[model samples]
Target: MKKENIKKVVLAYSGGLDTSIIIPWLKENYNNCEVVAVSGDVGQGTELDGLEEKAKATGASKLYVLDLKKDFVENYIFPTLKFGAKYEDYLLGTSFARPCIAKALADIAIKEGADAICHGCTGKGNDQVRFELTLKALCPDMAIIAPWREWDIKSRDEEIDYAEAHHIPLKINRETNYSKDKNLWHLSHEGLDLESPANEPQYNHPGFLELGVSPEQAPDTPTYVTIHFEKGVPTAVDGKEMGAVELVEYLNKLGGENGIGLLDIVENRLVGMKSRGVYETPGGAILYKAINVLETITLDKESAHLKEQLAQKYADIVYNGQWFTPLREALDAFANSLAKTVTGDVKLKLYKGNMINAGVTSPFTLYDEQTASFGEDEDYNQADAAGFINLFGLSIKERAKLSKSWPKIED
Candidate 1:
């Protein structure tokens, strides 16, 4: 975009140090462009506090905070859960949130007649692709600016210095500034000492991990809870039906207490790089496991196998910033179809990081106790197996008759 002609820009701002520093950077570089800050509330909870005042103090001309938590969990997160998509064991907390947040940025940019849409996603991360792809899909003509790619502040230390120089107030100092993302689905931690593969996570380090404790610190006794689902979406825990947001929040509390979900991995990013990170997805972990267990009895072998293969494709799409693509929409339709039989209750016993099945029941189960039992039943006869097995192995039998292995057996 031509800096001289641009009058205004819209920024995807979070009330964090990273984005806070960008507000001033845009004005200084873009010929004093007026920045309209937009933040989407996807259950970051207290993280959104004082965002308005912070945005204004940090040089944003105006701020628009949209309440997107309900839509976030219900639409984006639930579909991933239904498809059982996991990218290298990550629950995709930050991946899905980018589209929701970037959509808001695009809409606000268009509505405000802003010249460009800007974001603080780093040059090395997957989020830049996620944000830019959504912006291109929604508002292709709008000029897009990513501060990390353009700015000369080469490191977090330099960025902190810039923030302090501009008199920007921040919640983090240099030592504790882990690149983090938090939302309704989960929380993620990256950077700092976590950059090295050899370094074990300092789990007990003061404030290192949040949302849950380390598994070793979990209770000795297992915590049992029954998860109820209706058409693949988790509806309740222990017979208490709840709204989508409320249900996830409740499970977060229970799951966190038992150290339910904590993931660490080095994952391939869409930008052609691998980055190591830790994710805390307590409630999401419980739900993903619960739905898989519930589907075990309900789904037929062929359908279950087909869906299992498709789930990986769906996970790749979400991770690769293709959330707004037509292919993803088509996959979602199939996921919904497979999830029709996924209504049930899954009783799970959580001990440390382990999720053991206590019980599972569903109305549409394909398994029949009478037909499968060893005892005599009208649905099946023992003698029928001989003829069926003979027919099933006819090709093998014919081949064996023509083979030399028969001579060895006869001898």
Candidate 2:
């Protein structure tokens, strides 16, 4: 646990502003410990470009760029989708991603036999809890170092200054500074003008909107997309079968073009602070919408309703960094059982940020057209309604008779 004892440290590196400076800070504070940077490639695309060189240039002894795209989608994203977990209005993008990445970091640490695992999560953010809890769960004996809590760097400006002093190349400056976290599921923007709830997001600002145009700026024509699901996992887009990562990527283009998934919310962090964030989750929004429509047909009334109630609690568990707990696994088992019938196809119309369900179909649908029709059918007898109503209203009828027999009160 002591600084002198840490010979090598595995850091969760993103090649971002905070992490770029962290390499040097770790060396200075931890007696020049060998720093090994591990970057999780969760479909951030060009964000990971040149990351290895960048890490080495920043004084890291080595770098590992693990391709976690498929693992991230299949293991983390799909399970959460089955549970329909959303933390407030967040879609649990950044919330669930932390654990997935940390799990990878823990594995790499074990393989490298590193003395400590380091992260750039700040003291006041939910990511600190998420990353540390996962590390604690996966590798209980590993030493963990969080620089944001120990380092004296007070602000982003100080971090930038530290980067310059250490000759570490950075992609951010004070003026264009917006703290961003991007994964396959979503891209989250925070800080600067977003700190104030009243300031409208500057979507038009150069480099501000990476995914797509705003809803108002989208084309006038509507775009239609058909999604196929098998056992609650998205399998294809627009009649073309795709792998999990490819399907999400394909939908991201479509949804972004139509301005589909943009949200601004003020949410309660696990650290007990209210934080405002803007999220762009183009592909994920469409998938969630389509799957929910299919669930309506596939799931029975009680299972569907109970899943809705359980989703809130599941969201809390994920958001509060309890992903490895037994309760989460139990909930996943329930969700998976319900999802067995969730195979179907959903068609949707995307126009100006609106997702309108056009149609839904499933082989396991519970809807029976003949039984629900208004016309007389052999499945039901009209005379049965009278007896059924009488039995159903028996308590009400007894209460009424008792009320009449009671003496009237004086005015």
Most accurate candidate by TM-score: 2
Residue pairs in clash, model 2: none
The digit string of per-residue lDDT tens for model 2 on 289-323 reads 99999998899999999999999999999998899
RMSD values for the candidates in order, in angstroms, are: 3.1, 2.2
Worst 10-residue stretch by lDDT in candidate 1?
Answer: 402-411
Q: In lDDT terms, which candidate is top?
A: 2
lDDT for model 2, please: 0.92
- For each candidate, give its TM-score against the true structure: 0.95, 0.96
C-alpha lDDT of all candidate models, in order: 0.89, 0.92
1-411 in candidate 1: lDDT tens per residue? 688888899999897877999988888988988999999999988888999999999899999999998889988999999999998888889989999888888889989999999888889888899998998899999998888888888898998899889899888989888988888889888899899978998876658777888888889999999999999999988999899999999889888888889888988888888889988899999999999899989888898899889888998888888899999999999988888888989999998988899999998888899999988788997889999999999999889788856555653
For model 2, the run of ten residues with the poorest summed lDDT: 204-213
